[model samples]
Each structure stands twice: as C-alpha cells, then as structure tokens.
Target: MGVRWILAAGLWLAGCATSPPPSGLPDSLDVSSRHELTEVPFFPQRDYQCGPASLAMTLAWSGLKVTPEDLKPQVYSAKREGSLPPDMIAAARRRGRIAYPVTSTADLLREVAAGHPVIVLQRLESFWQTQWHYAVVIGYDLERREIVLHSGAEERLAMALDAFEQTWKPWGYWGLVTMDPRRLPASAEPKKYVKAVLGLERTQRWQEAEQAYSSALARWPHHLTAWIGLGNSRYALGNLAGAEQAFRSAVRAKPDSGIPYNNLAHVLMEMNRTEEALAVIRQAIRLGGPQISVYKKTLAEIQRRRNS
Candidate 1:
C-alpha cells in the first residue's frame, strides 16, 4: 500500500456522491463558498509515514519549524505500521501545540476557512480492507463541490466533497487541527478548548498553557477551569500576582465551586496574605464540593503558617 494504491482505491468511490451536508453548522461558516490555506506547507509522505507528514504540515502552519522526520519518532508506530491518533495528539501537545479534534465535516471546513489545515484519517479502500491513510485538508470549494488536500506525492489533490466524506466518515469523521495554544480553532467549544489546554498543562508547558487559558477566557469570559488553569500556570512561572488575579476571577466566575476558593487560598497564602488565605479557605470549606477533604487540608496548612 502506497500513494498510488491509496489514490487508485478511492477512484471508484469518487463519483458516487452520498453523504449530505452536516446540519446546525454555525452561521460564521457560511461566510465563504470557497476557501483555502495556500500558505500551509506540504510534505509528501514516504511509505507508512503519512501521519508524520500530515502532522508536520499542520504543525508548521501553526508557526513551528518542524519536519516529518523530526516528528516520526514521536508519532510513528512501526509495530502498528502507522501512527496512532492519540500518539499524534500527544506529539503535538509535547511540542506546545493544541491538537484539537474536528470531528464533523462542517467544522473541518470551518477550520480550513479560518486558515487552519486539518489532518484527517481516511479509509482509502473498502470497509473490509480498511486501508487507513492520513492526509491534510488545506482547502475546499463549496461552489465547485470539491475538497483540496495535500495528499501523498500530490501537493494538490482535489476530491469531491462526498468522496472525501466516504473515506473520512468511516473513521468517525475524525480530523484534527494543530494550532498554537495562544489561538483557538474557529469552531472551538468552551469545554473542548479547556480540555485541550489542560492536556497542554500536563506537558508542563506553562507559558503556552497560560496563553491558551487566557485566550479561552477572552472567548468565554470567566470560565472556571480556564481561570484556575491560568492561575496555576502563572504560579508555575513565578507570577504570584497574576495567578492571584486569575484565581480571583475564577472565584467570581463560580462562587459556589470550592475548587476555585481552595486554589485562591493557596495563592493568597503564597503571597503571605495569611489572613486573606484563611478567610478564603474557610469559605471553601463551608461551600465544599468534591474537594472537601482538600479544602480541610488547605485550612490546616494556612493555620500552621499563621502560628509560625
């Protein structure tokens, strides 16, 4: 199975249009009938390296100077004869990029129109054979009813929209848009965006996580997790004041959530505001949620500090 085999496999399926346009797409997506991210770089895959190649294109477009070769060790799986989707996601996260999944065709187009190239997995052959292939979708012409891709050995492969869906849908319409943490995908939902940022935070990329958290708050003001993550990241970077401000914002966002109060108490204690810390922890303990035990611990720690 190579590029030729993959292309040949899809030829019979290209002309028979089947999948319908997805419903409930945002009005913002209708702003264009034709759109393309021409600046998105292309890397022709070599053998079972389409995953790395496709990821490289999107990562580079996100302003990172990377190559398929550099990504192979991180994303490729010789045992599986290709890269796993989770591995691809982790690779992007490790590089300080958000690997946001664009599962619907409409959202994929939305991201492309917003100048983001998407990495999509396709089952090139019949469902039985399952010739799984990775490709980058960089453009689409809704007027002409075509999808543009930077496929293997073909920098500009144009397939019919329905044809692309036939190949993509079997894979659960699975696609991903790699982007800077500072930027959110055009079709980002608040919960998904915050989850992606949380994944980035696990990578210990505090700076990028901070940018993403800040961006999340900009879009969805006073999102509780976004504020808490922003505070945590700021604290990691030695910006106690900024962290305190973020925690304060979080406290305002969800006054009943003990999580924010517990975090805010910690930040206040770090700033040597022991009295304020005690007050915050007491509120958290009083209005406790899931972390009641953690709040109790925080109160004890604050008391210990005051006594010393």
Candidate 2:
C-alpha cells in the first residue's frame, strides 16, 4: 500500500494523465462497444483512500448503502496508509457481494458492457517506480478508444484505452467486478463463479451463498458443486425441503458419487424421514469413495433411530 507515498509526493495527477499508452497495446477493444453506467455512484478519494473510495462506489452500485469512510476500517491499512487488493475482495464478501477478479482486459470491458463497473489496480508510474492505485471503470468507448473511470477526485476520468492498458498491464490487467450474488458477471466462468461462492460461504453468509448457488445453478443447471453448495446453504438456513431438493439435484448431477447421497440422507433425517434416510445412507456407504467411514456412521445412526 505505497499508494499514500504517491499522493504525498504530488505524483497522483502526473501518473494517469501524462503517461502515454504503451507501444504494444493489444488490439482487443470490443467493436461497437460504447457504454456508460451513469447510474454508478462515485466517491472522491481523500488522500490515500482510493481503495476505500473505489470499493465504496462499486459496493453501493451493487445495492449496498456504504460510504468510503464506513469501508476504511475494513479495507484500509492504517500501517500502510492504503488498502490492499485482497482486503478489498474480503470487504466485498463480508457485505455479501461477489468480488470476482477480471483476468484480462477483454474481461474487464465485458463487465462494463454488461452494465457492471470494474475496479482496476494500476501502476500509475514507470515499472521501476511503481505507484499503485485503484479506480472504478464505469464506461468504455471502443470507437474513441477510451475508458471512463471514477478516479481520485475525477468523477468521469476519460482515459485512453491504450493508456489504461499501459497502467494496467504490469499488474496482469488485474481488476475486480463486485456485485450482488444473484448477478453474475458477463464473463464469469462456472468454476470461477463457484469458487467465489465458496468464499462467500466461508464468511458464513448463508443467505447470500444460497442466492449465489441458485444463480449458479440457473446458469449451470447440472453443476454438481452448485447443487451441493445450495443444499448446504439451505440446510444451514433451516430450509430442509429446499436442501432435500438441491441434494437430490446433486445426486442427479453426479449419480455415481456418494457425496450427494450422504448430504441427501442428512436432510431426510432432519425432515424425520428416517426410513428414506436409512436407504440413502446405505447407498452412500455402498457407493463411497473415501468417505465410506462417514457414510457407515450415518447408516449406524439411522439404524439406532429406527431401533429406538
């Protein structure tokens, strides 16, 4: 978080504006792409607070009512005087938002095209003298070869696409698309989305995880992981019926796997369908890979319940 040092030295303005685009700018701008998310909120950064400001804008746009100051404690490093990328992602997840990292320049533009703003990390100075800063990309004009960002104090900083790429490339075109669980990014991959959902679940945000898993299943109807996660989330939230359906879907998605059967058995037991639970657990025990011991335990418990 050397971001504060850049501002103290009065180099913040010099970094993004005066620097020209790299000579090897890839010809990757989407044709016919001209979109501006005018509805996106902008929070002007105060001092080394670009990270908080950028995150605030995206989170608010994603339907959370947050301000930069409110997010400072979560994202800002008091020792570093700036925020780190990982902290920004963690902050989003804490608020039940999916903070998916955009891997490429193409993917960043796709997010903007789909009406989602992207938060990008930039090396505002030369490679030797790296100046890290975060900004929110709210618009792009491919014909004009420019991308609009809510940077520092500028509400709409129209940066040359090539220039933005030059600042972004050193960071591996690192960017983030933060949004609600139900809204998947335009360029989201199923596995990547599932990983993000897993992060949300790790935060114990079961309601958000449920929404994310449901959305994932909508896009990937037969995805085993989504089905399993959905069942788990619903079970955590005490929706035994929904959990039963989701686990059943997981069984369908991977019929040969014992994992789903085991989960289904647990949900059936919770619903007091002890006979059905016993049958399912016995199936899990028979079809088990490495979890046969756990499946056997389940069978034993069901048998005890029946005997009692």
- Whose TM-score is greatest here? 1
User: What lDDT score belongs to each candidate, Candidate 1 first?
Assistant: 0.82, 0.81
In model 1, where is the ten-residue run with the lowest total lDDT? 1-10
What are the per-residue Cα lDDT tens digits for candidate 2 across 266-307? 878778799999989888878868778777877777677678
Clashing pairs in 2: none
Q: What are the per-model numbers of colliding residue pairs?
A: 0, 0
Off by over 4 Å in 2: 1-31, 126-129, 304-308
TM-scores of the candidates in the order shown = 0.89, 0.87
Give a tens-digit lDDT track for model 1, residues 157-210: 999888788888875788899889878899899988888888887888889989
Off by over 4 Å in 1: 1-29, 126-129
How much is the lDDT of residue 151 in candidate 2? Answer: 92
